[model samples]
Target: MVLAVRKSVEWGITAAKLFVRRECRILSTLPEKQEYAEKQIERAPSGRKSITKKSILESRHIYPEFLPDPNPNWRNSLREKLEREDMLKRRGQVEIPEFYVGSVLAVTISDPHAQSKTNKFVGICIERKGCGLRADFTLRNVVDHQGVEVRYDLYDPTIQKIQVLRLEKRLDDKLLYLRDSLPEYSTFPFDMDQEILPEGSEVPVNPIQVVLKPKPWVERWERQELKGIANIEEYLTEKNKIKRELRKTPWEKYDLMKQYRKTIPIEDQKEIWTEVYTQLHQLQSAQKKMSRKRVFTSPKSLLA
Candidate 1:
């Protein structure tokens, strides 16, 4: 019994010594491992860093229409899949360039009544709404001193060409307020030249604020908080200001449920973009090649 107890105590001491040695080795290597990790992080390429931070999910801003309606009532997975297929087919047919509400666009559509069987209109995009194939955009321009607005179906078969003369964003998502503002704000020359941005440049935002026309406007501009309008306060009375303040829902921004309802889930968005990214990339490459060819041949043609 004495020998057995002595053996047990010896084993316990041996085990404790082994544990201490193991812990000491780990502690000695910890700084080296940490330094190696820091070096790896520092040496990482920016492209890989960007991939980790911004994946295919960033494509959402470029192709927002590809996302299905977030409304649970309107959501039909099969229908959305079908719509996506149709939208891809239409996109294959038409090279619809990236554009925003404030961008200048020139659209040419097949018109049976037109002398040339095609009609071209140039204007500033005032609004873009809807999802899937039902998506549409409105363009406003002053022609012959009269304000004219044209609404066109984005994926219409009749659309021959969609050109972005100027690709830029406005302060507001929708520029419908331009309709009530000065005609100059909505106007664009029909022969406006395309402003080609350098490759990989971010879309520029126009911060120009518009002056609104006096009362008797189309909509109650005072009720809506418009960042692109400058002279809205001049048109608003004390009562109007009070009503505007009363209508403000400061808590809406903090309402996660409302945001969730308005946008598709990130995981779902990744899946959708993953399926379409390859095709979109191919289309973009083809377009770039064609554009380069055109640029090179144009000068020679002009000289000839």
Candidate 2:
């Protein structure tokens, strides 16, 4: 009977020890499990929030080309994301200035035919078309009594420089009529000096309206409702003038979605500019520093 009692006591002691060991294990793991649970809870909310700046949103208007094409058929959010990444990468390698249709530009391009393996062309920007990677521009100037216009792709790898000699806008979005205009209006000296505007000033709009030569234009100027031509009626026949009045779509200005379809939504624009803002800001800062250094180092007589 005593032996049975001792065995029972020993078994009771072993069970108590096992119970304590299990409790200790649970107690020891409690903090870690709690920590892991808290981490997951914290992480769940992290992915929901993103930061954007008002300045970046406002500044997107200055770089409209950075936004993806807004055509529904051509626009894929995934594709836009990839294209924006590629564009930002390209911008990091080269300097592209803010310019308008009327801005005078000098572009240096790698040319195999040139003796120096490069060629520089200077002219007034008559048009800027397309968007994203396909963005292109046309420069018009009179060379050797003949009109010369060069259309350049903004993102072409062979382009070495794009210097905005005069940063300004024109009355019209396109100056293609300059092709048919008098030679004096389209002519700009190839060696013309860059015109720098005052600091913190808005780009001035050249209010000069061009006068077109008599008939045989690339397009019917009368039918297009162009505002930049002063002598359009001189070239238009009475029948053509009547047709232009009949073709006018006065209601198009009120079509909100039509304009919206041509441009990225404000919300999407905010997101894109936010993503690339830091990189662009850094580049601008570097450029400012370089310009300041040049001003300080340049000879006073030369600067004057």
Candidate 3:
């Protein structure tokens, strides 16, 4: 979906084209603050061994895979501030509808590999995951008797448009189990067109439960503690129990340094939340203004 957008508004066409140029972006924003934790070294009060405060201080910063990915170098604070402002502006220009997992959506991504012109994929949103600038959603739909799922970075320039056919959340964050579930849970019309929820109207929630795969699931099924999966206890084999026990790191609790090596620090959290809250306020104000305009047009739009 290459947007051949030409605008006279960017002083001239060159600036507008430059404005929409594709820029590199990172997938996640975790693991950085983990590297900056202040760790303390232990020693006897006054022993022959002696206590020394070295500048290195044990150098204990390690990362785990499960944590969100890292932010990219090209990721600029000023640019992000501007991007958020633009998203707000775009919402006013076109209604940016609300959506959640289990919502069937028709997402149009700008694929350079696409043949002809527009490249689009329509599927049911199985997973709505990630946060901050990297937040993304996944769509699962079976096409041509084959199952297919695609994940899209919400704010990626590669995304031409996202149209919600059904906007709702599921019982779980990830519906990967839909892979083996019944066809109805994962099926969507191949030629299904987009649906528009009425402007400023309530986006309907679909509380559908999806069935999971049987025993020997791909993920740590027991630890994750999924509800949608039927009779997990029955699936728990003796070997699975041993694997779970072996996988557990009892020392991890006593390991303050280990825990310190795996998370964002207090200062970073303060900075992130400060920006998040400020942005949320801005979004709220914009929504309120949009609501007021709608109410002015029709008092009934707000609610009886």
Candidate 4:
């Protein structure tokens, strides 16, 4: 006869507790103010053990990287609990929204000392860079006869709200070259407001090509993939090909670092995303309640 191993939800939760207990044990073994303790041991050695143990436990909060990747082992229950706490911390402060590159956004960030506690910056997102807490987006707009670009971390503490004024896409991944291009293409009216598209509507396209300035720009325009370059073939010469050869990759030098930064690890994906899914469901429930409240208060609904 063969026997099967039965799994239980209670067991999973228990395993998680044990995991944290083990971490505490490892942390406790670390030298607890050995240098300072040595002097105290010589002076008043009576309650040395008691004071040192208390100090070790009390100072646990100051340990760096207290929040780390779920687990060293093939993740057990404890990892899930830590992940939930992290997600809740993120939720308590800023409300992150669903957004993508090429969307026009008005980001209001808190500036306490300013005349108004909020400062709003409106621009079109040209590109998204990185993932997780490191994720950031680049916003571009023309101001004072010059193009201006600002990169903001998606999860940064300063951002109050991110309103999608216009959700759209461009032909290229990044529109950084727009810096050296004609200001007219990048410019938008300062007073432009959000354009709310109907649900399931198609994303708009910005097919405008911008003209570039004379030589000596911030970047070698040729190195970047730019769609706005109308006369690219005309600009190309023997010099461009020579430059490409000089910049040849020497056997993928960045393979290890690139892999390290990539965020799609299979096991971590499950635990990290678990809390997000729960919070999203909670947000949906709260929105439903607000909708119900509004319907009851409306003058037309009350009359009917």
How does model 1 fare in lDDT?
Answer: 0.76
The per-residue C-alpha lDDT of model 2 at residue 182 equals: 87
TM-score against truth, every candidate:
0.80, 0.76, 0.50, 0.57
RMSD of 4: 19.8
Count of clashes, each model: 0, 0, 0, 2
In the range 1-304, model 1's lDDT, one tens digit per residue, is 9999999999868746754553222211011222435445744665776574344655666676888878789888788888988988888999988888888899999999999999999999998878889989999999998999999999999999998878888878888888788887877779777777767776777778998899789898877777899988887889998888999999985554465567776567767777888888788788787766554211111101
lDDT for residue 170 in candidate 3, whole number 0-100: 56
Error of 4 at 238 (Å): 2.4
Worst 10 residues of 1 by lDDT: 295-304
Q: Please report the candidate that would top lDDT against the real structure.
A: 1
Query: Between candidates 2 and 3, which one is better according to lDDT?
Result: 2
Q: In model 1, what lDDT does residue 304 have?
A: 13
Question: Candidate 1 versus the native: TM-score?
Answer: 0.80
lDDT per residue as tens, model 3, 10-40? 3445533432441000111221222222222
> Residue 299 CA error for candidate 2 (Å)?
18
The residue pairs in collision within model 3 are none
CA RMSD of all predictions: 14.7, 21.8, 19.1, 19.8
**In candidate 2, what are the lDDT values of residues 1-304, reduced to their tens digit?**
9999999999868746754553222211011222435444654555433222434654544565676666688878787778777777777777887788888899999999999999999998997877678888999999999999899998888899988877777777788889888888888777766666656666666667788998788888787777778988776788997888899999985554465455565567667777788888887777666555543221121112
Evaluated with TM-score, which candidate comes out highest? 1
Model 4: ten consecutive residues of lowest lDDT = 295-304
